[model samples]
Target: MSKQLVVYISATGTTRRVAQNLAKAIDADLAEIVPAPPFTAQDIDWTDPTSRASRQHADRAMRPPISASPSVDGYDEIFVGYPLWWDTAPREVRTWLESHDFTGKTITTFATSSSSTRGALGEQLHDSAPDAHWVNGRRFAANASEAELKAWADSIA
Candidate 1:
């Protein structure tokens, strides 16, 4: 069996739950992309256009901190998970992708969002990691059931 690693970053824990479910279903290793300091609830305020969160995203794009570093050479398949932000992935995810070498690895992306579809984000991921075997992307509800997540994982497997 090919070794798999599910690496994810979640703010409110929604994406984290989905990652956990997928990891369990695939019997893969679980790794978290933790920010160095972590984001407070206030740091995620999307409602305020002028807030630090919005301004940083607007100007610098994704600026999340990465606490753990990944060496993708060992994993045959990597499942990268995050929440869709501003119709794209969080900047931290981009940073994570840039930080590693995924030369010949298969990458599968999954996201959780309240409104945005997965199309735009998937395209962006493909653009970011052109060398990676970018599989399709899946969008799950904020509170998706474990069975639903497991079924999705099985289908992908």
Candidate 2:
């Protein structure tokens, strides 16, 4: 079996739950992309235009440092997951990808959104990671089932 890793950042556990299910179904290692200082409830207020998330989203240069990374040397396939914020993965995802060298790996992103579409996020991240071989990504609902996640993993793997 190919060694795989499921890496994700969960703002409020939506992406975390999906990542956990996908990892179990595919027998892959699990890792979370965490913010250095952590995010508070107020910091994640997307509704407020003045919130931390809002400000950071508006600025394309905000690549906050990631505090955690699992042993990725053994994994050939990487599954990147996050909830869609402003139709894109958070900048922390870019921070993590840039920090690691995914030169010879296959990367596929699985994202969730309540109202917005994935909106070319996989392609948008191409600039951040030029060497990675990116596959087409899939979008899921915030409450997607384990079977739904497993099916996508199986098809992609």
Candidate 3:
């Protein structure tokens, strides 16, 4: 069996729950992309343009520091999950991606969004880990079932 890893960041547990289901569905190891100092409820308030998340989204070059980066070594496939932020992965995700060398690994991105589509999420992340083989990403509803996740994983893997 191929070693798989599910890495994600969830500001309010929505993405976390999805990542858990995905990891379980595929029998993959799980890891969280926790931001340094963590995120407070107020930090992610999208309505507030000055909120941390908002500021970071506006700054294309901003890469928030992560608390820790999980080792990508030995993993044959890595699934990166995050809540869609401005139709793209969070800057924190970028930090984590940039921290690793996914030279020949297979990377699949998944996201959760109440409204927005996945957009060009997988392509947008290419520069951060330029050498990895990227698969097209999918956006799942928060209540997506284990079977649904497993089917998607099977199709990709």
Q: Which candidate has the top score in TM-score?
A: 3
What is the lDDT of every predicted structure here?
0.78, 0.81, 0.89
Tens digit of per-residue lDDT, candidate 3, span 30-139: 99999997988988788999988799888989988998798999998999998887888879999999999999899999998889885435788988999999998899
Model 3's TM-score against the true structure: 0.96
Q: Measured by C-alpha RMSD in angstroms, how accurate is candidate 1?
A: 2.2
Give per-model CA RMSD: 2.2, 1.6, 1.1
Which 10-residue window of candidate 2 scores lowest in summed lDDT? 118-127
Model 2: clashing residue pairs? none
Runs off by more than 4 Å, candidate 3: none
Tens-digit lDDT track of model 2 for 1-157: 6789999988888889888988888888899999877767887789998876897789988998778855467778998988777778888888888887888888898887777775424777877778888987888777778788888877876
Q: What is the lDDT of residue 9 in candidate 2?
A: 88
TM-score against native, each model = 0.86, 0.92, 0.96
Clash pairs (backbone) in predicted model 1: 62-91
| Deviating ranges (above 4 Å) for candidate 1 | 60-64, 119-121
Question: What is the alpha-carbon lDDT of model 3 when measured against the actual structure?
Answer: 0.89
What does candidate 1's lDDT look like per residue over 52-125, in tens digits? Answer: 35766687545556888666768988989888766666777877888787888888888888888754236676
**In lDDT terms, how accurate is model 1?**
0.78
